[model samples]
Target: MSEVIANMSMSLDGFVADTNDGIEQVFGWYGSGDVAVPTAVEWATFRTSEASAGVLRHGLATIGALIGGRRLFDLASGWNGQHPMGVPVFIVTHQEPTDWAHPEAPFTFVTDGIESAVAKAKAAAGDKNVAVASPTVVQQCLDAGLLDAVQVDLVPVLLGQGIPFFGELAKGPVQLDGPTVVEGQGVTHLTYRVRR
Candidate 1:
């Protein structure tokens, strides 16, 4: 069975990025430590604490597919055609990109809806998990009751206001259980299963 998990590094104040769409404040932990964690993409290796490295390696090994919003896709410039996770990426968008350079890449532009994207990603994942990478997609998954778990790489900072990790859920008050915690140098990894 493939479970859908929402994962992101968030600020202590609950923002994922600053008002200018900057993530330096929240993503500093990726390079703040001594342990090296390489990804599928050669340009984006992470240097984090040993604990965070373990968590990143575990996710890289287990997550089979990724679901993200079009906004994030554009922000990352389609991750140069290959995402760091080396998994298939399913982008939820109203329309496909007209001049996408990486047509041969394993990127699927899903214009129908989140449900359809999830179905395709799950089938692609086989027995592994589908990771939701965008905050908007996470919110949608929460509203649709499709998210199974939430993984928060909590960074210690107060952004005060910016792009939040969560938004107005159509289905409010989602309950979660058992935040298995792992402390890192400047961040804390927390995983909570969604209560059914």
Candidate 2:
């Protein structure tokens, strides 16, 4: 009974990552590439209203697991197996990771395919939400008709040449429900229920 969700921060122009732009530039707002792993005080405070907290605690309390793509895995440098929420992450990849970048924070790489990875993540998620956190996996889930909802933090900047967050889905015009916009300092969080 877990709902599959795909979420990410995208520029107003609809790009998740910039063209050849490093993680620091595209995802710098989160602190660093290992933004997934929050520090001790960050955990202690548990304050959602903090000025620097951009949807920080939004779904952190609900998500039970995460699914991401290979490119996102590489770009994020594997988050060194450290995720802010301490949830298990399943990486959908054709090739396995060659390095154990983060010993303490580890990732589970699924090679079978996106569906398989999602299935595993969903099972692991119990009754909580299984978040499809990578762009490629999100598109695949949408194409495969697996995702239940899509959440995006719409950033104000326009990265014109980066990889697109969404474009030409396998099916034409994926209908969306309420934007349910939540305004913050640097970004706006938008959530949509994918109309089947």
Candidate 3:
């Protein structure tokens, strides 16, 4: 079975976006000093047209499947429907949609539930990791006791209010198997292997 990895960038004060975050602004491809360090955000804001390219490269190469929510899908569609990850992808939504699948990279839409999504992603991933890229889906995975590990990169900026990773945990109780923390480039990256 493949590991369900929920990885997301959160504000230091804990907010994925403002309450009224328009789809255009929420899934920001570039760092706007919102969910990134000041130095990187500044550099990207000033120059570097491909600032987010590095982050995408690092994230996509590490996972075999990408899972996300409806809002995330809508936001990402603005990127010219480019499925940059180039792997099997799953979206947990009430509504059904389409992915402009390439002959080489085909996208799979899983709507039955989170479990179905996980199973399909695992099958698609083989031995690689299945990543839950959406914050909402990550929280649901936790609630459903489906996640095996969580990787959180705590940025320096503070949104104070917006979407959160943990909304209503319903898996009774969850324990973490020690956290590995690393402070680099002004952000603290924390990884916790889930001990369910």
- TM-score of each prediction: 0.98, 0.83, 0.74
Residues 1-196, model 3: lDDT tens digits: 5688887766677666667653223334344323432221222231112334344445556677777777787766622334555566777888676444342445555678888888888888887788887777887888888899887766677666777766667665688986777554434567899996
Off by over 4 Å in 1: none
After superposing candidate 2, which stretches have Cα over 4 Å from the reference? 23-54, 101-106
Instruction: Indicate the TM-score of model 1.
Output: 0.98
Backbone-clash count (model 3): 0
- Give model 2's TM-score versus the native structure: 0.83
Candidate 1, poorest ten consecutive residues by summed lDDT:
166-175
Model 2 per-residue lDDT tens digits across residues 62-95? 7889998888777766765676667888989888
Ranking by TM-score: 1, 2, 3
| Ranking of all predicted structures according to lDDT, beginning with the best and ending with the worst | 1, 2, 3
lDDT (Cα, tens digit) per residue for candidate 1, span 5-87 = 99999999999999998999889999999999999999989999999999999999999999999999999999989999999
Off by over 4 Å in 3: 22-60, 98-105
Residue 17, model 1: lDDT of: 98
lDDT scores of the candidates, listed in order = 0.95, 0.74, 0.65
The local lDDT score (0 to 100) that residue 106 gets in candidate 2 is 42
Whichever of 2 and 3 has more lDDT, that candidate is 2
State the TM-score for model 3: 0.74
